[model samples]
Target: PNLLPEQVTGTRIVSQGRRESDYNLIGLTDPRGNKYYWIGPQHEGELLRHDDTDYHAIGDGAVSVTPLHVDLTHEGALKSLREAFG
Candidate 1:
């Protein structure tokens, strides 16, 4: 099937795994004196951060394809770790 640019648009793939923490913890105590901590994902730069997926998916009207598996390993440290601990 033939497709046109106007009909189907390809968008930039937004990379995930932002090292910068984007969550917050709310500490509270119940009536029974039991302390509890609630962790939730904050709406941090949802549509403003360039590397964020929502930025392109929601802001831009295009197909946003996110990889199922992304390698977040620090390749630069591999050589040093190998030499030191090999």
Candidate 2:
């Protein structure tokens, strides 16, 4: 087809290492002035600092994709909380 399907968001099912590579491949800036990349899948809870750069597989019959934003604002909430508490 010459035109792309409306249901397709251009996203594909990627695997380990590949996902990480894609995540860190390049920085993509969105319309909201936020830059981000694919960072594997984050099903629940926040990602641990040590595990942030790791990739995981979803074998639970569910497809979860994590889009990690490349912006200082990512830690804005934590930074502000620390300042407020201190």
Candidate 3:
């Protein structure tokens, strides 16, 4: 998942083996300074299941590329702020 410059500074990832802490996984910066995060495949299953074939491909040493887009708006918070200020 790609994040806008404002949202990129304080992002966190909480998963098994990874503590719930700030993660600086930003890939690169363009001329405009947008930040990109390479979030791996989204899948369901503790162990490898047939439906997780795409994720499995990575485990087998195959190169995988998943594209993503950036959405900067925090919808729920934005709505609350709008109501409060309006």
The segments of candidate 1 whose C-alpha lies over 4 angstroms from its true place after superposition are 1-22, 30-33, 41-46, 49-64
**Candidate 2 lDDT over residue span 1-86, tens digit each:** 12346633343244332332222245678999998975644434343323222232233222335555456565878889999998
Q: Report per-prediction Cα RMSD to one decimal.
A: 7.5, 13.9, 15.9
The collision pairs in model 1 are none
lDDT of each: 0.63, 0.44, 0.47
TM-score (C-alpha) between model 2 and the true structure:
0.18
The C-alpha TM-scores of every prediction are 0.41, 0.18, 0.30
Please give the range of 10 consecutive residues that has the lowest summed lDDT in model 2. Answer: 15-24
Q: Going through the candidates in order, what is the number of backbone clashes in each?
A: 0, 0, 0
Local lDDT at 18 for model 3 = 15
- Largest TM-score belongs to which candidate? 1
Which residue segments of model 2 deviate by more than 4 Å? Answer: 1-74
Candidates 2 and 3 compared by lDDT, better number: 3
